[model samples]
Target: MKKYRKVSREFSKHTINALRYLVKKKIISQMLGVIAVGKESRIFLALSPNGEKLALKIYQIENPSFKQHVRYILGDYRFRKLGSTWWKIVTLWCSKEYRNMVRAYRAGIPIPKPIIFKENILVMEFIGENYTPAPLLKEKLPQNLEKAYDNIIKIIYNLYHKAELIHGDLSEYNILNFNEKLYVIDWSSAVNIYAPNARELLFRDIKNISIFFSKNGVKIKPVESVFREIVGESISQ
Candidate 1:
Protein backbone atom coordinates (compact mmCIF):
# COMPACT_ATOMS: atom_id res chain seq x y z
CA MET A 1 0.00 0.00 0.00
CA LYS A 2 1.29 3.47 -0.92
CA LYS A 3 1.17 6.25 1.70
CA TYR A 4 1.23 9.87 0.64
CA ARG A 5 1.82 12.38 3.40
CA LYS A 6 3.62 11.54 6.60
CA VAL A 7 1.10 10.96 9.36
CA SER A 8 1.66 11.06 13.07
CA ARG A 9 3.86 8.19 14.21
CA GLU A 10 1.84 8.01 17.40
CA PHE A 11 -0.36 5.38 15.69
CA SER A 12 0.14 2.07 17.42
CA LYS A 13 1.51 -1.01 15.68
CA HIS A 14 -1.90 -2.61 16.17
CA THR A 15 -3.50 0.12 14.01
CA ILE A 16 -0.86 -0.39 11.33
CA ASN A 17 -1.55 -4.13 11.36
CA ALA A 18 -5.26 -3.45 11.13
CA LEU A 19 -4.68 -1.48 7.92
CA ARG A 20 -2.80 -4.43 6.48
CA TYR A 21 -5.67 -6.73 7.44
CA LEU A 22 -8.15 -4.51 5.58
CA VAL A 23 -5.96 -4.56 2.47
CA LYS A 24 -5.76 -8.32 2.67
CA LYS A 25 -9.51 -8.47 2.97
CA LYS A 26 -9.73 -6.24 -0.18
CA ILE A 27 -11.71 -3.68 1.77
CA ILE A 28 -9.29 -0.87 0.88
CA SER A 29 -6.84 -0.76 -1.99
CA GLN A 30 -4.56 2.16 -1.13
CA MET A 31 -4.04 4.88 1.43
CA LEU A 32 -3.83 8.19 -0.37
CA GLY A 33 -3.12 10.62 2.44
CA VAL A 34 -4.28 12.17 5.66
CA ILE A 35 -7.60 13.93 5.24
CA ALA A 36 -8.05 15.50 8.69
CA VAL A 37 -6.99 15.14 12.28
CA GLY A 38 -8.86 15.56 15.54
CA LYS A 39 -8.25 15.24 19.25
CA GLU A 40 -8.67 11.47 19.42
CA SER A 41 -8.50 10.28 15.81
CA ARG A 42 -6.96 10.82 12.36
CA ILE A 43 -8.86 10.54 9.09
CA PHE A 44 -7.16 9.27 5.94
CA LEU A 45 -8.36 9.29 2.39
CA ALA A 46 -8.21 5.83 0.88
CA LEU A 47 -9.44 3.93 -2.15
CA SER A 48 -11.38 0.70 -2.43
CA PRO A 49 -10.51 -2.23 -4.68
CA ASN A 50 -13.10 -0.82 -7.10
CA GLY A 51 -11.33 2.55 -7.04
CA GLU A 52 -14.07 4.19 -4.97
CA LYS A 53 -12.94 6.82 -2.47
CA LEU A 54 -13.22 6.07 1.24
CA ALA A 55 -12.41 7.79 4.51
CA LEU A 56 -10.61 5.81 7.16
CA LYS A 57 -10.99 7.19 10.67
CA ILE A 58 -8.38 5.69 12.97
CA TYR A 59 -8.82 6.34 16.66
CA GLN A 60 -5.62 6.95 18.55
CA ILE A 61 -5.00 4.16 21.01
CA GLU A 62 -2.86 6.28 23.30
CA ASN A 63 -5.21 9.24 23.46
CA PRO A 64 -4.89 10.88 26.86
CA SER A 65 -8.56 11.94 26.91
CA PHE A 66 -9.87 8.46 26.21
CA LYS A 67 -11.17 8.46 29.76
CA GLN A 68 -13.45 11.43 28.94
CA HIS A 69 -15.26 9.18 26.45
CA VAL A 70 -16.36 6.84 29.23
CA ARG A 71 -19.34 9.07 29.99
CA TYR A 72 -20.69 8.77 26.48
CA ILE A 73 -20.23 4.99 26.48
CA LEU A 74 -21.50 4.30 29.97
CA GLY A 75 -24.83 6.01 29.38
CA ASP A 76 -25.29 4.27 26.04
CA TYR A 77 -27.47 1.20 26.56
CA ARG A 78 -25.89 -0.37 23.49
CA PHE A 79 -22.63 -0.59 25.40
CA ARG A 80 -23.64 -2.12 28.71
CA LYS A 81 -20.14 -3.06 29.85
CA LEU A 82 -17.19 -0.71 29.68
CA GLY A 83 -13.88 -1.93 28.39
CA SER A 84 -11.13 -2.67 30.94
CA THR A 85 -8.24 -1.15 28.96
CA TRP A 86 -7.47 1.94 26.91
CA TRP A 87 -7.13 0.00 23.66
CA LYS A 88 -10.42 -1.76 24.34
CA ILE A 89 -12.11 1.55 25.09
CA VAL A 90 -10.87 3.15 21.88
CA THR A 91 -11.84 0.11 19.84
CA LEU A 92 -15.34 0.11 21.29
CA TRP A 93 -15.56 3.85 20.64
CA CYS A 94 -14.76 3.27 16.98
CA SER A 95 -17.44 0.59 16.76
CA LYS A 96 -19.90 2.89 18.50
CA GLU A 97 -19.32 5.55 15.82
CA TYR A 98 -19.90 3.04 13.06
CA ARG A 99 -23.18 1.93 14.62
CA ASN A 100 -24.27 5.50 15.20
CA MET A 101 -23.56 6.42 11.57
CA VAL A 102 -25.52 3.42 10.39
CA ARG A 103 -28.48 4.47 12.51
CA ALA A 104 -28.32 8.07 11.31
CA TYR A 105 -27.85 7.13 7.66
CA ARG A 106 -30.75 4.69 7.78
CA ALA A 107 -32.88 7.39 9.34
CA GLY A 108 -32.27 9.69 6.34
CA ILE A 109 -29.79 11.98 8.05
CA PRO A 110 -27.18 13.57 5.79
CA ILE A 111 -24.07 11.80 7.06
CA PRO A 112 -21.29 9.94 5.38
CA LYS A 113 -22.39 6.38 4.75
CA PRO A 114 -20.51 4.02 7.06
CA ILE A 115 -19.04 1.08 5.15
CA ILE A 116 -17.38 -0.98 7.88
CA PHE A 117 -15.16 -0.81 10.90
CA LYS A 118 -12.29 -2.95 12.16
CA GLU A 119 -10.42 -2.57 15.40
CA ASN A 120 -9.88 1.16 15.95
CA ILE A 121 -10.48 2.13 12.33
CA LEU A 122 -13.79 3.01 10.66
CA VAL A 123 -14.18 3.00 6.89
CA MET A 124 -16.85 5.26 5.40
CA GLU A 125 -17.83 7.02 2.18
CA PHE A 126 -15.55 9.89 1.32
CA ILE A 127 -17.37 13.23 1.61
CA GLY A 128 -15.12 15.18 -0.75
CA GLU A 129 -13.77 14.95 -4.25
CA ASN A 130 -10.33 13.94 -5.56
CA TYR A 131 -8.83 13.32 -2.12
CA THR A 132 -9.64 16.89 -1.07
CA PRO A 133 -11.99 17.19 1.84
CA ALA A 134 -15.00 19.47 1.76
CA PRO A 135 -14.64 22.77 3.57
CA LEU A 136 -16.17 22.92 7.01
CA LEU A 137 -19.29 25.01 7.59
CA LYS A 138 -17.20 27.40 9.63
CA GLU A 139 -14.60 27.67 6.89
CA LYS A 140 -17.04 28.42 4.06
CA LEU A 141 -20.50 29.42 4.98
CA PRO A 142 -23.21 28.67 2.43
CA GLN A 143 -24.65 31.55 0.39
CA ASN A 144 -28.19 30.92 1.52
CA LEU A 145 -27.78 31.09 5.26
CA GLU A 146 -31.52 30.73 5.77
CA LYS A 147 -31.73 27.48 3.84
CA ALA A 148 -28.64 26.16 5.53
CA TYR A 149 -30.09 26.97 8.91
CA ASP A 150 -33.35 25.19 8.08
CA ASN A 151 -31.54 22.12 6.80
CA ILE A 152 -29.54 21.80 10.00
CA ILE A 153 -32.67 22.11 12.10
CA LYS A 154 -34.32 19.33 10.09
CA ILE A 155 -31.29 17.12 10.61
CA ILE A 156 -31.43 17.68 14.34
CA TYR A 157 -35.13 16.90 14.37
CA ASN A 158 -34.69 13.70 12.39
CA LEU A 159 -31.79 12.68 14.58
CA TYR A 160 -34.03 12.94 17.60
CA HIS A 161 -37.43 11.76 16.34
CA LYS A 162 -36.38 9.39 13.59
CA ALA A 163 -32.93 8.04 14.42
CA GLU A 164 -33.50 8.14 18.19
CA LEU A 165 -29.96 9.51 18.49
CA ILE A 166 -28.51 12.76 19.82
CA HIS A 167 -25.50 14.33 18.23
CA GLY A 168 -23.88 15.20 21.53
CA ASP A 169 -21.47 17.50 19.75
CA LEU A 170 -23.02 19.53 16.96
CA SER A 171 -21.22 22.61 15.72
CA GLU A 172 -19.81 24.20 12.60
CA TYR A 173 -16.47 22.49 13.16
CA ASN A 174 -17.80 18.97 12.59
CA ILE A 175 -20.17 19.91 9.77
CA LEU A 176 -19.02 19.94 6.15
CA ASN A 177 -20.14 22.29 3.41
CA PHE A 178 -19.71 20.25 0.24
CA ASN A 179 -20.85 22.23 -2.79
CA GLU A 180 -23.32 23.96 -0.47
CA LYS A 181 -24.60 20.62 0.83
CA LEU A 182 -24.40 20.02 4.56
CA TYR A 183 -23.00 16.73 5.82
CA VAL A 184 -22.68 16.12 9.53
CA ILE A 185 -19.65 14.16 10.67
CA ASP A 186 -18.20 12.73 13.88
CA TRP A 187 -20.58 10.23 15.44
CA SER A 188 -18.53 8.78 18.29
CA SER A 189 -20.00 11.22 20.76
CA ALA A 190 -23.60 10.61 19.65
CA VAL A 191 -25.86 8.98 22.23
CA ASN A 192 -29.26 7.36 22.12
CA ILE A 193 -32.34 9.35 23.12
CA TYR A 194 -32.78 7.35 26.29
CA ALA A 195 -29.25 7.91 27.51
CA PRO A 196 -29.03 9.46 30.97
CA ASN A 197 -27.47 12.67 29.67
CA ALA A 198 -29.34 12.69 26.38
CA ARG A 199 -31.52 15.71 27.19
CA GLU A 200 -28.56 17.83 28.17
CA LEU A 201 -26.58 16.79 25.09
CA LEU A 202 -29.51 17.37 22.76
CA PHE A 203 -30.11 20.81 24.20
CA ARG A 204 -26.48 21.64 23.75
CA ASP A 205 -26.51 20.42 20.16
CA ILE A 206 -29.52 22.59 19.31
CA LYS A 207 -28.04 25.55 21.10
CA ASN A 208 -24.78 25.25 19.23
CA ILE A 209 -26.45 25.19 15.83
CA SER A 210 -28.85 27.99 16.76
CA ILE A 211 -26.06 30.14 18.07
CA PHE A 212 -24.01 29.67 14.91
CA PHE A 213 -26.87 30.48 12.56
CA SER A 214 -28.14 33.38 14.59
CA LYS A 215 -24.73 34.97 14.73
CA ASN A 216 -24.57 34.68 10.96
CA GLY A 217 -27.87 36.60 10.56
CA VAL A 218 -30.15 33.64 9.92
CA LYS A 219 -32.83 34.95 12.33
CA ILE A 220 -33.10 31.65 14.13
CA LYS A 221 -35.67 30.86 16.79
CA PRO A 222 -34.76 30.73 20.45
CA VAL A 223 -32.77 27.61 21.39
CA GLU A 224 -35.46 26.50 23.78
CA SER A 225 -38.17 26.93 21.18
CA VAL A 226 -36.26 24.88 18.64
CA PHE A 227 -35.45 22.23 21.24
CA ARG A 228 -39.04 22.00 22.32
CA GLU A 229 -40.21 21.68 18.72
CA ILE A 230 -37.88 18.75 18.13
CA VAL A 231 -38.44 16.82 21.35
CA GLY A 232 -42.09 17.90 21.70
CA GLU A 233 -41.41 19.20 25.21
CA SER A 234 -39.69 22.15 26.84
CA ILE A 235 -36.19 21.57 28.19
CA SER A 236 -37.42 22.07 31.74
CA GLN A 237 -40.55 20.01 31.29
Candidate 2:
Protein backbone atom coordinates (compact mmCIF):
# COMPACT_ATOMS: atom_id res chain seq x y z
CA MET A 1 0.00 0.00 0.00
CA LYS A 2 2.77 2.42 0.91
CA LYS A 3 4.68 1.60 -2.27
CA TYR A 4 1.57 2.18 -4.40
CA ARG A 5 1.07 5.61 -2.80
CA LYS A 6 4.70 6.45 -3.49
CA VAL A 7 4.11 5.61 -7.12
CA SER A 8 0.71 7.33 -7.28
CA ARG A 9 2.38 10.51 -6.07
CA GLU A 10 4.13 10.63 -9.41
CA PHE A 11 0.75 10.79 -11.19
CA SER A 12 -0.85 14.11 -11.97
CA LYS A 13 -4.31 15.31 -10.88
CA HIS A 14 -5.53 14.38 -14.36
CA THR A 15 -4.48 10.79 -13.76
CA ILE A 16 -6.18 10.71 -10.36
CA ASN A 17 -9.38 11.99 -11.96
CA ALA A 18 -9.28 9.13 -14.44
CA LEU A 19 -8.97 6.55 -11.68
CA ARG A 20 -11.83 8.14 -9.80
CA TYR A 21 -13.90 7.95 -12.95
CA LEU A 22 -13.25 4.21 -13.20
CA VAL A 23 -14.47 3.71 -9.63
CA LYS A 24 -17.50 5.91 -10.27
CA LYS A 25 -18.36 3.75 -13.26
CA LYS A 26 -18.08 0.60 -11.12
CA ILE A 27 -15.42 -0.78 -13.41
CA ILE A 28 -13.14 -1.38 -10.46
CA SER A 29 -14.03 -1.25 -6.78
CA GLN A 30 -10.47 -0.81 -5.49
CA MET A 31 -6.94 -0.83 -6.70
CA LEU A 32 -4.86 -3.73 -5.37
CA GLY A 33 -1.32 -2.96 -6.47
CA VAL A 34 0.94 -1.86 -9.27
CA ILE A 35 1.34 -4.82 -11.60
CA ALA A 36 3.79 -3.34 -14.05
CA VAL A 37 5.37 -0.05 -15.09
CA GLY A 38 6.59 0.96 -18.53
CA LYS A 39 7.92 4.03 -20.26
CA GLU A 40 4.50 5.49 -21.11
CA SER A 41 2.16 3.88 -18.59
CA ARG A 42 1.84 2.13 -15.23
CA ILE A 43 -0.47 -0.88 -14.92
CA PHE A 44 -2.36 -1.55 -11.70
CA LEU A 45 -4.09 -4.66 -10.50
CA ALA A 46 -7.60 -3.90 -9.40
CA LEU A 47 -10.86 -5.73 -8.68
CA SER A 48 -14.44 -5.01 -9.56
CA PRO A 49 -17.12 -4.94 -6.91
CA ASN A 50 -18.05 -8.45 -8.04
CA GLY A 51 -14.44 -9.55 -7.43
CA GLU A 52 -13.48 -9.74 -11.09
CA LYS A 53 -9.85 -8.86 -11.67
CA LEU A 54 -9.04 -5.90 -13.89
CA ALA A 55 -5.95 -4.11 -15.13
CA LEU A 56 -5.83 -0.33 -15.04
CA LYS A 57 -3.27 1.39 -17.26
CA ILE A 58 -2.46 5.02 -16.59
CA TYR A 59 -0.59 7.02 -19.21
CA GLN A 60 2.19 9.36 -18.06
CA ILE A 61 2.20 12.63 -20.02
CA GLU A 62 4.87 14.49 -18.07
CA ASN A 63 7.69 12.75 -19.88
CA PRO A 64 10.00 15.11 -21.74
CA SER A 65 10.11 13.08 -24.94
CA PHE A 66 6.35 12.95 -25.29
CA LYS A 67 6.70 14.47 -28.72
CA GLN A 68 8.24 11.21 -29.87
CA HIS A 69 4.92 9.55 -29.00
CA VAL A 70 3.23 11.38 -31.88
CA ARG A 71 4.68 9.03 -34.47
CA TYR A 72 2.21 6.28 -33.67
CA ILE A 73 -0.80 8.58 -33.40
CA LEU A 74 -0.36 10.54 -36.62
CA GLY A 75 -0.54 7.56 -38.94
CA ASP A 76 -3.77 6.12 -37.60
CA TYR A 77 -7.00 7.33 -39.18
CA ARG A 78 -8.94 6.84 -35.95
CA PHE A 79 -6.91 9.65 -34.34
CA ARG A 80 -5.73 11.80 -37.20
CA LYS A 81 -4.98 14.84 -35.05
CA LEU A 82 -3.15 14.06 -31.77
CA GLY A 83 -4.71 16.96 -29.84
CA SER A 84 -2.85 20.18 -28.92
CA THR A 85 -0.94 19.51 -25.69
CA TRP A 86 0.97 16.59 -24.29
CA TRP A 87 -1.85 15.84 -21.86
CA LYS A 88 -4.45 15.61 -24.62
CA ILE A 89 -2.13 13.51 -26.71
CA VAL A 90 -1.69 11.14 -23.81
CA THR A 91 -5.44 11.00 -23.26
CA LEU A 92 -6.14 10.17 -26.88
CA TRP A 93 -3.35 7.64 -26.72
CA CYS A 94 -5.23 5.89 -23.96
CA SER A 95 -8.41 5.80 -26.03
CA LYS A 96 -6.48 4.52 -29.04
CA GLU A 97 -5.25 1.53 -27.08
CA TYR A 98 -8.75 0.80 -25.90
CA ARG A 99 -10.16 0.96 -29.41
CA ASN A 100 -7.34 -1.09 -30.87
CA MET A 101 -7.82 -3.77 -28.26
CA VAL A 102 -11.54 -3.83 -28.97
CA ARG A 103 -10.95 -4.30 -32.69
CA ALA A 104 -8.43 -7.08 -32.16
CA TYR A 105 -10.44 -8.76 -29.44
CA ARG A 106 -13.56 -8.71 -31.61
CA ALA A 107 -11.55 -10.26 -34.41
CA GLY A 108 -10.59 -13.12 -32.08
CA ILE A 109 -6.99 -12.00 -31.73
CA PRO A 110 -5.41 -12.85 -28.39
CA ILE A 111 -5.16 -9.44 -26.70
CA PRO A 112 -6.04 -8.02 -23.34
CA LYS A 113 -9.78 -7.21 -23.43
CA PRO A 114 -10.40 -3.48 -22.98
CA ILE A 115 -13.06 -2.58 -20.45
CA ILE A 116 -13.21 1.20 -20.47
CA PHE A 117 -11.16 4.40 -20.84
CA LYS A 118 -11.30 7.82 -19.21
CA GLU A 119 -8.85 10.56 -20.07
CA ASN A 120 -5.39 9.07 -19.73
CA ILE A 121 -6.52 5.84 -18.08
CA LEU A 122 -7.73 2.56 -19.54
CA VAL A 123 -9.24 -0.46 -17.77
CA MET A 124 -8.91 -3.93 -19.22
CA GLU A 125 -9.14 -7.64 -18.36
CA PHE A 126 -6.10 -8.64 -16.35
CA ILE A 127 -3.88 -11.21 -18.08
CA GLY A 128 -2.82 -13.52 -15.31
CA GLU A 129 -3.99 -15.98 -12.70
CA ASN A 130 -4.50 -15.61 -8.94
CA TYR A 131 -3.61 -11.87 -9.10
CA THR A 132 -0.20 -12.89 -10.44
CA PRO A 133 0.50 -11.21 -13.79
CA ALA A 134 1.84 -13.32 -16.61
CA PRO A 135 5.50 -12.90 -17.50
CA LEU A 136 6.45 -11.27 -20.76
CA LEU A 137 7.84 -13.58 -23.44
CA LYS A 138 11.04 -11.62 -23.09
CA GLU A 139 11.08 -12.28 -19.37
CA LYS A 140 11.26 -16.05 -19.86
CA LEU A 141 11.94 -18.30 -22.80
CA PRO A 142 9.18 -20.73 -23.77
CA GLN A 143 9.89 -24.45 -23.53
CA ASN A 144 9.01 -24.95 -27.20
CA LEU A 145 10.46 -22.16 -29.31
CA GLU A 146 8.98 -23.64 -32.49
CA LYS A 147 5.47 -23.65 -31.09
CA ALA A 148 5.86 -20.14 -29.71
CA TYR A 149 7.19 -18.85 -33.02
CA ASP A 150 4.34 -20.46 -34.97
CA ASN A 151 1.77 -19.01 -32.62
CA ILE A 152 3.31 -15.56 -33.00
CA ILE A 153 3.25 -15.79 -36.80
CA LYS A 154 -0.38 -16.85 -36.71
CA ILE A 155 -1.17 -13.89 -34.47
CA ILE A 156 0.51 -11.53 -36.92
CA TYR A 157 -1.42 -13.04 -39.79
CA ASN A 158 -4.73 -12.71 -37.97
CA LEU A 159 -3.95 -9.17 -36.87
CA TYR A 160 -3.37 -8.20 -40.46
CA HIS A 161 -5.86 -10.30 -42.42
CA LYS A 162 -8.74 -10.48 -40.00
CA ALA A 163 -8.22 -7.46 -37.77
CA GLU A 164 -6.83 -5.31 -40.60
CA LEU A 165 -4.19 -3.98 -38.20
CA ILE A 166 -0.44 -4.01 -37.88
CA HIS A 167 1.24 -4.25 -34.52
CA GLY A 168 3.76 -1.44 -34.83
CA ASP A 169 5.73 -2.72 -31.83
CA LEU A 170 5.33 -6.49 -31.97
CA SER A 171 8.20 -8.26 -30.18
CA GLU A 172 8.90 -10.57 -27.29
CA TYR A 173 8.70 -7.62 -24.90
CA ASN A 174 4.99 -6.97 -25.51
CA ILE A 175 3.79 -10.60 -25.70
CA LEU A 176 2.76 -12.53 -22.60
CA ASN A 177 3.15 -16.29 -22.30
CA PHE A 178 0.68 -17.87 -19.91
CA ASN A 179 0.33 -21.66 -19.85
CA GLU A 180 2.07 -21.72 -23.23
CA LYS A 181 -0.64 -19.56 -24.78
CA LEU A 182 0.53 -16.30 -26.34
CA TYR A 183 -1.39 -13.12 -25.57
CA VAL A 184 -0.22 -10.08 -27.48
CA ILE A 185 -0.46 -6.97 -25.36
CA ASP A 186 0.24 -3.29 -25.97
CA TRP A 187 -2.10 -2.30 -28.83
CA SER A 188 -1.26 1.39 -28.42
CA SER A 189 1.39 1.12 -31.09
CA ALA A 190 -0.80 -0.72 -33.58
CA VAL A 191 -1.78 0.98 -36.85
CA ASN A 192 -4.35 0.25 -39.54
CA ILE A 193 -2.97 -2.17 -42.10
CA TYR A 194 -3.97 0.34 -44.78
CA ALA A 195 -1.98 3.13 -43.19
CA PRO A 196 0.86 4.60 -45.24
CA ASN A 197 3.60 3.21 -43.04
CA ALA A 198 1.86 -0.06 -42.27
CA ARG A 199 4.12 -2.10 -44.55
CA GLU A 200 7.25 -0.88 -42.85
CA LEU A 201 5.80 -1.45 -39.40
CA LEU A 202 4.65 -4.94 -40.34
CA PHE A 203 8.08 -5.81 -41.71
CA ARG A 204 9.73 -4.54 -38.55
CA ASP A 205 7.35 -6.56 -36.38
CA ILE A 206 8.13 -9.72 -38.34
CA LYS A 207 11.86 -8.98 -38.19
CA ASN A 208 11.78 -8.52 -34.42
CA ILE A 209 9.94 -11.81 -33.93
CA SER A 210 12.16 -13.69 -36.36
CA ILE A 211 15.32 -12.39 -34.70
CA PHE A 212 14.09 -13.25 -31.23
CA PHE A 213 13.11 -16.82 -32.17
CA SER A 214 16.20 -17.37 -34.33
CA LYS A 215 18.37 -16.43 -31.38
CA ASN A 216 16.51 -19.02 -29.29
CA GLY A 217 17.38 -21.77 -31.81
CA VAL A 218 14.05 -21.80 -33.64
CA LYS A 219 14.27 -22.59 -37.37
CA ILE A 220 12.13 -19.70 -38.53
CA LYS A 221 11.59 -18.55 -42.06
CA PRO A 222 13.17 -15.32 -43.34
CA VAL A 223 11.48 -12.11 -42.19
CA GLU A 224 10.69 -10.99 -45.73
CA SER A 225 9.20 -14.35 -46.57
CA VAL A 226 7.06 -14.24 -43.45
CA PHE A 227 5.95 -10.70 -44.24
CA ARG A 228 5.03 -11.64 -47.78
CA GLU A 229 3.03 -14.60 -46.54
CA ILE A 230 1.13 -12.53 -43.99
CA VAL A 231 0.36 -9.64 -46.34
CA GLY A 232 -0.29 -12.10 -49.19
CA GLU A 233 2.19 -10.35 -51.42
CA SER A 234 4.68 -11.93 -53.81
CA ILE A 235 8.28 -11.45 -52.76
CA SER A 236 10.51 -9.93 -55.43
CA GLN A 237 13.44 -12.20 -54.59
Winning candidate number (lDDT)? 1
Off by over 4 Å in 2: 1-10, 234-237
User: Per-residue alpha-carbon lDDT of model 1 for 99-206, expressed as tens digits?
Assistant: 999999999999999999999999999998776999999999999999999999999998999999999999999899999999999999999999989999999998
lDDT of 2 by residue, 51-130 (tens): 89989888887766567767777767799876888888788888888899999999999888888889988889898999
- lDDT of candidate 1? 0.90
Q: In candidate 1, which residue ranges exceed 4 Å CA deviation?
A: 2-10
lDDT of each: 0.90, 0.85
The positional error of residue 27 in candidate 1, measured at the CA in angstroms, is 0.9
Query: Hey, what RMSD does candidate 2 come out at?
Result: 2.3
What TM-score goes with each of the models?
A: 0.95, 0.93
